[model samples]
Target: MNLIKTAFCLIILICSSIPVWSQTTGKIVDTDRQPVEGATVVMQLPDSTYLGAAISAADGTFSLEPMADRYLLIVQHLFYQSQVVKGQTRDAGIIVLEPKEHSLAEVVVEGERPLVTVEQGKLSYDISAISKKHIVNNAYEAICKLPGVQDRSGKLSLIGAKDVTVILNGKASTLTQEQLIEMLKNTSASQVQTAEVMYNTPPEYHVRGAAINIVTAKAADNTLQSELSATYSNQYFGSYSGNVNFLLTKGKSSLNVSYNPGYSHIMTVMDLASMHQYDGQVYDITQRQKINTKGWKHNIYAEYGYQINEDNALSVGYNGALSGNGKGTIDVNGNFQNSHNDKVQDSWLHNVFARYSSGFGLDLGVDYTDYSMNDYNHLESELTGHTRQLLDYTSDQKIRKVSVYADQSHSLANDWTLKYGVRYDYTDNRNSQLFNQTEGKDNVDNSSSRLYEQIANLYAGFDKEFANGLYLSLSATGEYYSIGNYHKWSLYPQASLSYSPSEKHTFMLGVSSEKEYPTYWDMQTSTTYMNAYEEIQTIEGLRPANVYSVNANYLFLQKYMLSLFYERIDDYFTMEMYQAKDRLALVYRTQNWNYYQSFGMSANIPFSIGNWLSSQVNATVVNDRNRCDHFWDIPFDRNKWACMLSMQNHFSVGSQLGFDLDAMYRSSMISGISDTKPVFMVNVGAQWNFLKDKASLSLNCSDLFDTMRMKVKNRYAGQHIDLNMGQYSRTVSVKLVYRFGGSITKEKREVDSSRFGH
Candidate 1:
């Protein structure tokens, strides 16, 4: 309690010392008086010093704070010529610009948007600008439209890097990567302003590897508001699900809550032909298997925020999920087995954050999470022609985690920034399994593990713009990590250089290094039997993987982007399946491989047809190579080529309706010993708004051709397995949303406790 009070007092002191500035407002429009949304408005002092910048809202209106009574204002938009207005006051009134094509160069095409831009080592995509040309339903879909983002086997990745993290509103969350992806899929992207991608994490971010930070727009024009939304989905395997969300905002306080309860039914079928060398003879085994599963899931989340002042704020959040028992039936080689399982998880977070205009920022946060899961399996089989057999298995697991961190940042002259932070994280996990044979003995296995970690990081760097439109950023992080009885310290370095040779082109080059840590469960020395023919295992003493990469990028007219990159990973973990005991069963395990390398190139282009239809396309090609071996002592080496092509289209029908079409295709790829087949998917959606634009209804159909399935072939010495997996890809969904508000308002952003929970 004393610590809390002390921290609160510190933040209050910082906030109280901040100097207040006078506010300003203005609007921008084209020569024809059409609103120029997404225009950059900047205020400059007499000495040409930057006061601040803001983006023109959808209505071409903007607000800023300036320290001087009279200043110079600059308005810039890609579609329009730059405008400079001097002697501007608090209310600058209306500023107009001529179309860019009217100038000598004719650089910018009408109705085209500069969707992607790189500044000071960060790549940012203006979501609102892109959404004008492409159809984006949710935040996840919006991210998928970025330059290098791809969905591979139902998982999101950036430029072939699978180890990526997400940050919301400059704060980390306590959800797993998969959970975060789900949440983003359900979240509407209309609330977001920009999506920033970082290939090499900076020291101030306090995270490793590639990351995507979602920056949300602060509401403008304060007014009480509420939004209610609901969605219904019909998935594959004859299952249906529904969800609802409600949000309320008034003044500086806002509340958001959601609930989702759904059921899942799925069936998997596989045909296998295996050959094993036993007793100087090769035996051929052929079998057909079918598995069916059904289960129910419930998830809930609530978050509330209040602004204590202009610079300080507090927030609290909760997330919980529960899954009911799932019944499974399997038919393998004329043998039958049955099983069931259930799980529950809960987490909470609280944060105290403060920001000062004097270039000092502080964040103090704490988070706690608890997870419990239990599964009971009963198997009945009759295949040997002797007698009916029965077996029982029970597994139980529990995990608890607590994390606290304090971070501070200070700004210096000449665009230099200094940051330092410390974090304490603790975790405890317990797992137990019991196996019994009806006619034989009983086997019991138990494992308990605990980890206490502390990390302290310091980052210092300078971002400077020199002559000839050249900008450079150099930053390095010194981090010390202590876990259990081991202690290590390392320095990560990052650098980037970019130059705009002309209005038509910008070039960039960067290099950085990052580390990838293993998940808590991935390092446990435990074994789990999934069924009569499959088992799961993990190796102990797993170490963090290290990555080093470099990239070069070129931007043509800000509407088209091209990039090339190379990445190398050491101590990489690969998942492999092997034949156990003469092809009787399969064992799945994760083991560290020698190394993995990839070289890739990507391109993103946006275009418009007339004024009612627009589209964006993205493509990538890569050469992937890996040196690894199967668990059954078989050497494996592979060098494969991969490619992905995606296109999104948006069409406007009159003034109250809109339609969208999206498609993506990927060539074959390799993961460990498994070679996956090619896959493609197409989706279409339509939205209608009514009730004075306060209510919206949207209908969507996914996987129109039903090709979003995973087909893989695993091969090793004297063993082969062909497998197929299906998910909820082929589905139809409808969403209804209603809002009651006078005007949208902005809320203060606070650094939360998400970074620690993970």
Candidate 2:
């Protein structure tokens, strides 16, 4: 207890000793007396040394801390003339900017606008500038075009970072990854103002890792907006998806609604060859498996916001996802075994949230989520020198979660900003598996399990800016986790420093620590059969991992970026295949590793050829090592080197026609006891606009050469396996979009349900 008291006193002393500065306040408006939102406001010295920056809110009000008694204030907007003023501890009241007299065609040809800018602790991308040069249709597509961001399958991640959390309008989102991706797909690109990427997130964001914040344009008073779009794709089968969105603002109240529906049919095939040596016998087995599935999905969202006064606001929202009648069939053919299986699944997810914010830097929020899933499976198989076998089972899972948080920020004397927050989360999960028929020798049994978890977190941080164009931020979080009989307390500390001496060069360094928990389904004791010879099982006593990471980045010319990163994780876990020692069965399970480490470097280079073509290239090289001293009965240590390359090109003919070509390649890599082969893929797309820029048609083709198949080989003390996995990777898609309404904007809030489902 004495040590704790000493640490607390040290923190208080450090915070009180920092210097303070005076506050600068201002407002911006257009020539028509209408407020201008999303304007950039900056404070600097007479010699052009950067001090601080902020964005104008919906009411055209902004505040900044200026360490010096005298400074210059600069205001800039997209469609208006820049304005500058000299001030000292005073408010600049009602500054007006004149609209530029330029046509849309002329605006597209202006080459002076920069695509990206380096701010205090983030990299900001101008979405409007990028849209003018590319054929971007939605928020998801625009994010894919950002430098150093990679799109693997349908998921997005930074090139040299760990997990990424996406937020909207500076608010944390609680939706699952799949739900968030769908929402971004349905959102129109015109509503986005800027995208900010942060390597080490600040404490005010209420998140603990790297993040991407999407800032949307604010709506005009007393306006209504709506949009409709449809898509069709063919990849050995037909699929359809459509969305509708509406927004309304009147007086002090705003309402937003959106709906999306989709239907798909998919097919995949895999081949496996295994050499099993058990009980002094060696058996060679080969099998081919095919799976066909069809499903229907629907998503709905609604939100309402009320502004009680200039300094207070309230918002409430609901989001839901429903899918049912999903059916699948599997067929297997092998030299020693033959099997057929049928399965059906249904699921539902619901989330509700509310938030309240005050002008005095106080924010309070609450969220709740409920999720459920049901599955049924039946299998029939025949084995060589054995009788026919049958197996049937049903599984059900349910989860409920609740979260509450409060945050506060204070502006101190000089130029110090202090922030602190506290949050609590509780989760309850129930799972059951029942067997109806069993005809063959079985090692699995009917099981039921219930789990309860709780987490409490408290964090505080400070930010400071120096007169030499340098910025620094530091934060620390204490967390307590309780699950069943496991209880532990951990501390996570983060720090970042950035320097921008000039417009042509910027450098940043960051260090962070976090903890990652496994999925709920992976911890339950259960067995699932895929065929007569293969099965999957879940184990007990799985623990979360602790991750520590460091990264450094350099930007030159505002278009090229270089990054170096290193990371180490303790108690890492992943899935691996093992040969049963007493039988001719193969098992797949998730197990823990002692440690994992990696070091990597990446580069992003962008260029253009006149006004007709623009292109970007990305390359990364990484070395990974894994160690385990007690993995099953065979322990080993492995290391390997891997590399990746990708390029994206865009071609524009005039202002209404555009084309896009992209390609990616990945070298061979190793994971645990497996070695994967190389992969390559190419994609093409085209877009055309008509009807006074209100209608658009687009065509896209992916994996043109069908070269995305994956092959793996695993060889160890007594395990030998070769697997080939192929899916419907090649597809042709066409989309149509039409817009007719007032300017559109959307505000979204979500509940975290990532750990609620299988």
Winner by lDDT: 2
Question: Model 1: per-residue lDDT, tens digit, 339-434?
Answer: 222222233323333322222488776666667666666665553434454556665656666666667776677656566666665656555555
Q: Mind sharing the TM-score for model 1?
A: 0.79
Task: Evaluate candidate 2 by giving its C-alpha RMSD to the native, one decimal.
Answer: 11.4
TM-score of 2: 0.86
Clash pairs (backbone) in predicted model 2: 20-413, 20-414, 21-413, 21-414, 174-750, 174-751
The models' CA-based lDDT, in order, is 0.66, 0.81
- Candidate 2 local distance difference test against the native: 0.81
What is the clash count of model 1?
Answer: 4
What would the per-residue lDDT of candidate 2 be over residues 1-758, giving only the tens digit for each residue?
Answer: 37435733653453344322124666788786655667888889988999877766444655565568888889998878899988866566677877766568556433356667877778899876677566677888888888877667667888776577888988876666776787787787767888998877776777766788998977644445567899998988898999777666555777777778889788888899999897888889999999988899878777889999979999898888888879999989998799999999998988998889999999998988899999889999999976688989888999898989999999987799898999999999898889899888466689888889899989999888887879988999999999889999999999999998987888999898888787788778888888898988888778888888888999888888999998888998888888888788888988789988888999999889988999989999999898888877888799999999999899998778999999999999888878899999998999998764567899988898888888888887878999988666798989898875323576777657766565
